[model samples]
Target: MFSTSIRFSADCVDDHVWLGDLEAAENTFMLDKLNITHILTILDYKPVYNKDDKRIRLYIEAEDIGSYDLLSSFETCYHFIENAVQNNHNILIHCQAGISRSATIVAMYFMKKYTLTHEEAIEKLSNKRCYHMVCPNNGFQSQLQLYHQMNYAVDKTHELYKDFQSERLRTNYGLEKSDKITKTEKEIIDDTDRFPIKSEEKTLETEEVEYQCKTCQHKLFTRNDLFYHQQGRGKSDWSTKPLELDETICDKQVFTYYTDWMIDVFDSNVGDIHCISCQTKLGEYSLDGKKCECGHWVMPAFHFDQNQIERHNEMNHNHVEKS
Candidate 1:
C-alpha cells in the first residue's frame, strides 16, 4: 500500500519534524493544519504541485539504491532541519514512497540530534512509523554505522568516500566497475620487476612499523604507512551483512594513503604496487581507488594485496621522537 500517512517523530511531543510520502507532502490541508514551513525533498527529479501555493522546498537529488550515497547529503538536510528545530517550525523530509531515501535521512538526523547509534535511531524511528517499516538498505545502514564511527561528521579521507567517488566518476565517464575499464595498466614483467628503492626513502622513518613482502620477507613500506580507517573496528566498511561469509563474497584488501615514495604514482593517479625486493607484482592502487568486494572505499588508495605482503608487528618497532 502507498503510505500517504504523514507520521510524526515518536519521541518529539512538540511534533516539529514529520516523515511521509509525496502524496502527504503535496496535501494543502495537512500543511495548513500542521503549519509546515520547510520541505526537504530527496528525489532524482523535482515535483510541481498547485500553482497558487508558495512554500520553501529544499531538493536533494538521490536514489534509494544502497550504493547511492545519501550520507554526503546528511549535513545539508540536517542544517535545514536544525534551523526549523531551533525556530520551532515544522519541517517534512520526503521522497517518492517515503521508504528508503527520506527515511534514511530522517534516521541519520535523529542519530545526530540525539547522539544515538544506527540501531538505536532506527528502533526509535520505527517505534513511531512501524507500519511504514523504516529500514535503510544494507549499504545505507553501513554508512550510518560509519557516520557514528566518524562522530557524525563526513571523513573525506575515509576509504569509503574514495570508493563512492570512484563509482560516481565511473558512472559519469561511462566506466563503472561493471564496464571492466583497465586501459592504463603498466606492462610489468618479471624481468623488469626490480625497481631501485631510493636510499633516502628507506631510512626516513626507521622507528615505525611497516608491511613486508611475504614472499621475500623484505620490507614493503619503510614504516607503518597504513591508512588508518575506522573500518574493521565498529562493524565493517559499508557492510551490515553477517561477518562470516563465503570466500567469494568478501575479498578483503588494504590501502595505504599517499606517502613520499608514492609521489610518482599520485602524479598519474593510478599505478601498480610491486615489491622492491623481488619486483613481484603485489597489488594495484589508484587515486580513484578500487572498490572492495565488500562495499568499502578509499581514495588515493595505496593498498597492497594481502597474499603478497604481511604487516610488521608494531610492538617490535621503536617510536622515534622528532627533534
Candidate 2:
C-alpha cells in the first residue's frame, strides 16, 4: 500500500514546478502519463498551475519565514497539512527546489509529532524524502534558528527578543513619557482611580516647590526667587520685564515665560533624548531638541541628556525658529 516515487525529475529543485515554463510542460506530461493518483505534492514555494484537475490536492511550503509577522502565514499552511493528514488526505508539498522549505516543514512535523530534535528530524526527512534538501540561506536560517533555540534552550531566546524590544522602546529618545504611560492593569486601575479628578481638575494641586523661571540665563531654582523676578522686587541678576508695554514690546518679553514652560516640560536639553523622529536612539537630548524647534517632527521631554538635545538643536536650529 506504501510506495515512493519521483515521477518527474526537475532541472533545479530550487522550488516547486515552474508551472508555466518549459519544465512545467515536461512535469505535466509525466503526471498525465504516470497517472499520478495519490500524489503528496511537496513544494518549497508557490507551485505552477498545471492542467486543471480539482482532484489533485497540493500542499505548499515556504523556505524561510522572514519575521514574526510571517510566522502566521506559514502556520496556516502547516495547519492545512495537519488537517489533510488527519483526514488521510493525499497532499503535495513543494518548494522552489524541494530542498529547504519543504524539507524544513517535514522536519518540523517529525519534531512535533515524533518529538525529534531539529537536527534529528531534519536528518530523518532528508534521508527519507530527498537527501539533497538542505537548510540554505535566505530567511529560513533565522526562522530555523528561532525555532531551534525556542525548542532546546534553557530559557527561551524568543522571550529575550521580546524583552529587548520592550527595553528598546523604554530607552528610546523622548520615550520616558511613553515608559511612564503604559497600559498595565495596575496602571489602568491607578488611572481609573484618578479619572474624575484628572478629567475635571485643571490646576495642579501640589505642595509648593521652589521652581525658578527656567527661561532666564541665571540658574534660579526656587519659587520665592521666581516670585521676586516676576514682581521686580529686588536687584535682579537677569534683565527685568519692562514695566511699560503699551505698544513698544519686543519678542523677548512675550516669549520669555512661555519659554520657561517649554524648558520645564519638553526641553530636549534637560533629560535623555532619543531621536523623537525615529524613536531609535537611547538617552536624552536638550529641551530645544524637543519638537525639533525646527520644522522636523520630534518629541520633547524633560530630563533629556545634554548632548542629544544640543545636537538636535544645532541640527534643526533653522527649522525650529520657523516652527
TM-score of each: 0.51, 0.37
What does candidate 2's lDDT look like per residue over 210-267, in tens digits? 2222223222222111100111222222234323213211111111111221222231
lDDT of each: 0.63, 0.35
Candidate 1 structure quality by residue, lDDT tens digits, 219-270: 7663334443322222354345534333221224565544433322221346
For model 1, the stretches where C-alpha displacement exceeds 4 angstroms are 1-15, 163-323
Residue 313 Cα positional deviation in candidate 2, in Å, after optimal superposition: 20
Best model number under TM-score:
1
Alpha-carbon runs more than 4 Å astray in model 2: 1-6, 10-51, 55-70, 148-323
Q: Model 1, clash count?
A: 4
Best by lDDT: 1
Tell me how candidate 2 scores on lDDT: 0.35
